[model samples]
Target: MSTKLNRIDLNLLVYLDALLRERNVTQAAHQLNLSQPAMSNGLRRLRDLFDDPLLVRTSDGMTPTERALELEPQVREVLMNIEQAVQPRSAFAPEQAQRVFRIMASDYAESTLLPAVLGKLRVQAPGLTLDIMTPSDVSFLDVERGKVDMVINRFDSMPQSFHQIHLWNDSFSCLLSPENPVLADFTLENYLQAKHIWVSKTGMGVGVGVDPDDVQRLGWVDSALARLGKKR
Candidate 1:
């Protein structure tokens, strides 16, 4: 707190950590492979920077002062974070890995895609955890921030920065009772004329074109009808 950030020596943190752990100036110097005099100079600089006698002489030996004890865990944690930042990530092996993956999926995909996904995980990565969430529960911001790992569904549009892939080509079917009169004609005109049920749809991802009045997004069947300037 006493020294300006630009004027303080970052190396003092290493010296202070070693000194606190070893509790002896000569021992701390030996741990850092530095001479006793150099270590003492570092302790002086640290004291001036923090305006605290971080370590005080004791009857038995050197002991950390109250301030040094407070800084001990914080300093170790900072050093650990720096080491992790500089280290290369270890190669991942599914069989040995323990990780959590967050996925946003629609009900349709829950029935179709998740079974195989769970099967693979059960066989290869038993230790991994999957948190499958409905599309309504998350947003693109979650994906950008790594809170959500992936979204599986149709995308009307997406940000240019997103990495995308075509999982598979799929088709849809409309069911009707065999005795229905529409079975006699089975044409687009007849189908449009028939009263139909509108089930709620989801997993369309985040898009501006999804508004109900957008015409192009009025569900697959209605969107086709809209292209012909028609509505069911």
Candidate 2:
């Protein structure tokens, strides 16, 4: 018989499971700590709802009907699933746990920062594993959907939806040979006058993404230069 989900009493499934397992009203009531009459009432409701005898009297004992036999295992499985669903989760014990954590980070973060974090995890969470992916390989959509556990990188801007923390302050340092003439007078004027190569991607991918030509997506140095009425 067709049944509307909202019309069904889910608790009846528990009563039905106990009834089918016990195969006798008195025994089923004992199993559930209910009176014999209460179990009998439950049986009446089950019979009415399913429109089946569900059980029958036989000389040997109470026997399950063909329909009841078919339902027995299915009912048992459903009860087991419900039991698990309601069970409270145990607190994490990292020393006794094994799990994989996924991380998405930029190349700069991967090289400069992640090594220390990995070193500590190796000692404290010996069974824990990390799956590292670069920013260029993954989109913010992956992070929003929880496919990536964490992201560690510099950002010119981030979505208000993303929970952010300030890790540390960083700045651009010029790497030049000792003989380089720029080092003679390393003032803002000398630095800007010298030819330079700008290499930064933190501002390239904003949220889901943006066009590479979008000057509004410029990185820290370029943005700072723009504020000072200059271009990098």
- On lDDT, the candidate that comes out on top is 1
* Model 1 steric clash total: 0
User: How do all models score by TM-score?
Assistant: 0.56, 0.53
The total number of steric clashes, by the backbone 3 Å criterion, in model 2 comes to: 0
- Residue lDDT tens for model 2, 136-175: 7777656643467788887767756677888888877778
lDDT of all predictions, in order shown?
0.81, 0.77
lDDT of 1 by residue, 1-232 (tens): 6557678666888898888768899999999999999999999999988899998897979978888877876776676678889889987799998889899988888889899989999999999998999877888756644468889988778865567998888887879999999999899889888877656456352243356576654566667777788876
Candidate 1 Cα RMSD after full superposition onto the native fold (Å): 15.0
Q: Give the RMSD in angstroms, all C-alphas superposed, for model 2.
A: 17.2
